[model samples]
Target: MKQTTCRIRCVNALVLAGVIATTLAACSADPGATPTTEPTTAESTSPIDRFLTPTESVPPTAYPSATNSEQVANNVVSWYESGGEEQITGVRDRSKEIYSHHAEDNWSIDFSLFFDRSKEAQEYPPIPDRKTQAAWSTALKHVRSGASDIYMSNQLGIVRGSKEVKREAHGWKELAQGVKGLKAIEARLHREFGLDPLTSP
Candidate 1:
């Protein structure tokens, strides 16, 4: 009877161990199978995906009509004639008011070119004659040079110190010459192009 009882207890202990081992094995992940990963969210992928986004677009500005171009040309001439030259020259005073006025005037002239009329004038039919083209090119060069001179003069004038003030005075002289050169080119451009007179106010 004692031998039978001991045998029964050993069998029961073995069964219990086997059952625990099986349970552990089932709970653990399968090493032979492929590991699954969660899908990536947009926020995580946004930087890489941004290159696929469409570009934002803007509408193009239209060129000005012939009548508007003529009027703009006339206006430019009138502006220059009506003491525009004086306003720039008067920067020699170096007063805050004078500087503001000069800057405003220059900006007005520069901004005017953005109008449709100015675009039309710039896109005017090309001249066939080499001489005429050369003249036009020269005039354009002068206009650019004049604008540079005025800008440089204004910059130099803003420098603080007596020496800078003197330098500013010298810059004013150069600016004056540039203004004259541009005025001359303006006249030539108007006459040659058969547009409204740029020199006549």
Candidate 2:
């Protein structure tokens, strides 16, 4: 009976030795190595960086929309007659205010002569295609031959500045002398360029 007990103990010792040896081999095979299943090329990017890869821009430039207010304003006047250019030039003289702000984190943006100009659009070479026409681009246009009123949109609703050969801004709601034609301009701006006529300055 003593010999049988001795034999059972010897078998148990051999099984324990095998388990320790297998565990040690597995741990040493890849010391400090990352798991093979994880991805190595994963990355992250911010909202602004996406503009770098865009292929489309207003006026079709590889660079940003307008270098400065003067360039855009001048380009607009080129589409107008000499007398109209001189008149439109006077109002746009105020450092060329362009509206480009988006509020409440919404995709749609409001533009206004009441709102000051922002050069934020200049930073990017190619801006990402927007959901609507840029407000500043619409604001810059004037008739090459006919008359156009210099209108400003603010919280008080649409306001007309001037329509006659001479332009002037007298007050917020009322100014200038011409047909209601400027209203159509504002309407077209809102429709094509996302200018919320109701948006405040």
Backbone clash pairs for candidate 1 read 64-116
Candidate 2 deviation (Cα RMSD): 16.8
Reference-based TM-score, model 1: 0.27
Give candidate 1 regions above 4 Å deviation: 1-125, 156-201
lDDT tens digits by residue: candidate 1, 1-201? 999999999999999999999877866755765444765675566463566435321111232333655654554334334433332223212222222435344432332232232233234433333344454444334433434444444453365567645554554454444345434444554574443432242
Segments of candidate 2 deviating more than 4 angstroms: 30-201
Query: Which consecutive 10 residues in model 1 have the weakest lDDT in total?
Result: 89-98
Best by TM-score: 1
* Total clashing pairs in model 2: 1
Query: Candidate 2 lDDT, tens digit per residue, 52-86?
Result: 44632223333235576555444333322222222
